[model samples]
Target: MNITVFCSAYSLDDRYSVPAAEFARLLGSGGHTLVWGGSNAGLMGLLADEVKAAGGRLVGVLVELLAHKGYQGADELVMTADLAARKAELLARADAVVVLAGGLGTLDEVTEVVELRKHGLHDKPIVLLDTEGFYAGLRTQLERMEAEGFLPRPLAELVSFAGTPAEVFELLAAAS
Candidate 1:
């Protein structure tokens, strides 16, 4: 299945490089497509590199603006004219989304999916790969949404949390 993973160009330890690369390899080996930001720096770079090394298809969606800001481009990428076009392409191509540990950038992505489902734009599954309690706070916020009237309990059920790379990928496989 074509699975898009939303992540950032950096990792906190900044040690997220290896894990991102490893996750890409694992997904590739499991016959899943690797989709991410088109950059060859930090986690973004490692993810694409790992996918290429594993002989898996790596598709990158990047805005012409941030293409070089991150240092490089994806192994298999098609440049977009602007951020809007890039995002549209990324969302259109993926069957499912797996959000790994990321900073504000990743948070924006996950929230976009939530908003999409909330507005009835789409009903795609969103899997949060919360390694090391990365998404604990976001999870809490979502739970609060369900508690209040801001988000319906049924709509809030759209997102799933997976604590490990193995668990997240397994969920992806099951979606097929």
Candidate 2:
């Protein structure tokens, strides 16, 4: 599977890094490809390193402004003119999407994908790894949206939340 992962570009605490690394190892050892932002910084860099070390293929989609920060060892790298194009390319390359703990940028990426799925623009499975309940607030908001009839489809059908690295793969496997 070509898994597109949206995550922090900033160096994170061990609490977040540990799970991200575990997820990377699984993606690599399982003979999958990682499709992500083409940055060799922070958590994004760590994920690429772990995945590459574990034998996974890396495909990076980078925006022009961040091209200088692109990973040196990606199996393939694509340069986009802007963030919107980058997101489009990322989704176009992914068989599924996995979101790890991140700040606003990561949130933006995941939100766009989810919205696309909700509009029937794509059917790819989207999973969020809720490490340390980092996504609890978002989950509550989404649940409220579901309860309020704001969404046309069931919340479960739109996205699934997993609590660990193993659970992320288990959900992906079942979805595939």
Candidate 3:
């Protein structure tokens, strides 16, 4: 399985390394490939490093601007001129998406995946690693969209939520 992990650039820290490593270890143990933002910082960095350390094939997709931010870790790099292009490239090849706790950038990328599911552009599974209920408000707003009929129920269900990386990876493996 090839999984694309959607995550925030801001939340990268040593604190996040263990869970990231756990997720990578699980996937590596299962003989799956890991794909993610090619960043050297935050959760993105941790995931790529651990996945590679665990002997998994890791691919990094990064936008030009973000790459200049000095936060990328792709043994193999895909450089896009911009963020939108970066997402497009990832969407083209990733069979699944796991969203770790992140901020606006993370939200933006996840929104693209949601919209992609909405339009039937892809049936790829999306799992949200809630990480301490990081996505509580976001889920509420998505539910509100469902209530307003702005988003269909099935579309809203495109994203599964888990409080731990273990659960998120389980959902992702099932998706595969």
Provide TM-scores for the models. 0.88, 0.99, 0.87
- What's the true lDDT of residue 49 in model 1? 71
User: Cα miss at 130, model 1 (Å)?
Assistant: 0.5
* lDDT of residue 21 for candidate 1: 67
Question: Taking the tens digit of each residue's C-alpha lDDT, what string does model 2 give over 58-169?
Answer: 9999999998999999999999999999999999999999999999999999999999999999999999999999999999999999999999999998999999999999
Which has the greatest lDDT?
2
Evaluated against the true structure, the overall lDDT of model 1 is: 0.74
Stretches of candidate 1 above 4 Å error?
Answer: 11-15, 69-75, 153-156
- For residue 41, give model 2's deviation from the true position in Å: 0.4
Tell me the lDDT of model 1 at 68.
67
Writing each residue's lDDT as its tens digit, candidate 3 over 75-130 gives 57888888888888887868888887777888899998988898788999988877
Look at candidate 3 and tell me the lDDT of residue 125.
Answer: 90
Residue-by-residue lDDT tens digits, candidate 1, 1-176: 77788887774454455556667888878776777777776677777777767777778887788766442434467789976677668778888888877777777777887788777787667888777777888888878877787785463357888877788777766765
What alpha-carbon RMSD in Å does predicted model 2 have with respect to the real structure?
A: 0.5
